[model samples]
Target: MSRVTILVYKGFQVLDATGPAAAFEIAGHFGAPYSIRLASLEGGRVASSSGIAVETVPLAEALQCELLLIPGADNPLRAARQKELLTAIADAARSGRRVASVCSGAFILAAAGLLEGRRAATHWAAVEALKRLHPRTVVDAESIFVEDRGVWTSAGVVAGIDLALALIGRDHGDELARKVAQKMVVYHRRPGTQPQHSALLDMVTPDNRFAPLLAWARARLSEPLSVERLAKEAALSVRQFTRAFTQATGVAPAKAIERLRVEAARAAIEAGADSLEEVARRTGFGNGDRMRRAFVRITGQPPLVARTGARREPGMRG
Candidate 1:
């Protein structure tokens, strides 16, 4: 059996440790050999940022596990300053054990010198801070998670589940990971390359006037969603619809459509077994070139790079 240890400290995000622990536990029920435990710098109950306390073993005792997980906190910089904790993490990685962090826990890993010159992911809000603090590390601001060599890092909160699913898939098989994910009721596992933010959510607020229209546009991405078509669907003149949409969502109708198309295309590129041309066609980009341009504009990378980063290992689950 592979022993998995999650290291925690005061103020750690509760989900970062528990979510992955749940995923690993469920995978065990599916016949994967995993033994899970929670550990802290000193054995006892550690209070989380949410005011919930969890019992833990001493970190030194748990350091020899097959996998070590570091959970982020509300203010990870404070945790990163724990010299002994950082030393333990650095020693574990140097011994060739797989190590991973969830959310701002990447800051701790970076502090331990584990993420230097490696691609890592953290909570979006902490991306710039991480980059500024650890200039040698490559911070991927958008990925749900990132695995470079034996080190892994995930974005904020529930993304720890996605990171766990990926690790389970790597250790066992994609089928087992999928079953575990189904048991957990997540997306099967969102690809690590999938952006943490959604274009639809970014574009519309809860009570925005055009929420329904945006949802409709998303459902019919293959259809020609011109400003006139959207205006007609909304039963407003093109001028009024354009003005209201810009005011409500802060972007022009055409730009919004392009963002939606890029978002859909990106999902298809990362998870679907479709060619770039087919994904472009299905998402209303018409061709790869147009899709590429939109992807660069919206995602800051081309579809090919996204696909390569997402599927770096063949048969790897999301």
Candidate 2:
């Protein structure tokens, strides 16, 4: 039985912390290996961005946690309180718990010196701020979340939900994680290397300039999608297309294509592809070797491991 402690501080981004907490509760319903507890640096109640108050137990009381989650907040400029938060995080780390962060929660982990010489990810808007605070940490703005060793860090806001699902998958298995995700209506799972934001728009608007292009690419996940082809389709020069694509999507075209293909492959695999080569070819990866490389690059695993160790149960054929 694993135990989890979620640390909430003042002015915390409510969704960043609560989203994952809620998802974990769904996992709990399936008898997953977790006992959830919410904690705070200061004992008693903690306030959220939306003026809602949530109960918080003392951090010290959560002594036996297998995982400790630190949530980000709107008021990251609270430098004084940051020290206290960092101290608490360090204590949690010393207790052998896998400490993780949501959004600017990476800031807390960095302050605790847990992210030193480690690769982490955070909200794209805070990339510069995180860099200035902790120069030694490699902050990848592109990723939705990162799990290096035992320290996990996620992108801003709702990306925390995805991070928690990944943890569920890691601790228990893919089947439970997928069930939790399904229950929560998280139709897709973003790999750690996938971009934090969507490829269609910088924000969540249906009127984005690249909406059509995004739809086009998504509709044809089984086709070859090279930079040149995408550029041509967008009627722009390669450099221009790359810059515009990144600006609009928060990710490069090539990266987006890889993500789409991987997602398609995962769906196909979960639907019971006969072999790696079949999954690869069906997802436009051409062959098992290419699929293996892409799997390693995107998911930090080989083809076989990703298939068997996926977070979803193998379903009926697609």
Candidate 1 segments whose C-alpha is farther than 4 A from its true place: 202-212, 222-224, 233-235, 244-251, 274-309, 313-318
Q: Which ten residues in a row have the lowest lDDT in candidate 1?
A: 309-318
How does each model score on TM-score? 0.86, 0.70
What C-alpha lDDT does candidate 1 achieve relative to the native structure?
0.90
Give the whole-model CA lDDT for all candidates, comma-separated: 0.90, 0.77
lDDT by residue (123-204, candidate 1, tens digit) is 9999999999999999999888998989999999899999998899889988998899899888764788787888889989
Q: Write candidate 2's Cα lDDT for 1-318 as tens digits.
A: 778888887788888878988888888799974678888776699888788888988877885788898888876657325676678778878767788889888887888889999999999999998999789999898877887777899998888987898888777776787799889988544556555555335432587777788778878777888999899999999999999878887888888788777767765664446787877887788998887788788778776664453334221112
Best by lDDT: 1
True-structure lDDT of candidate 2? 0.77
Candidate 2 segments whose C-alpha is farther than 4 A from its true place: 197-199, 202-318
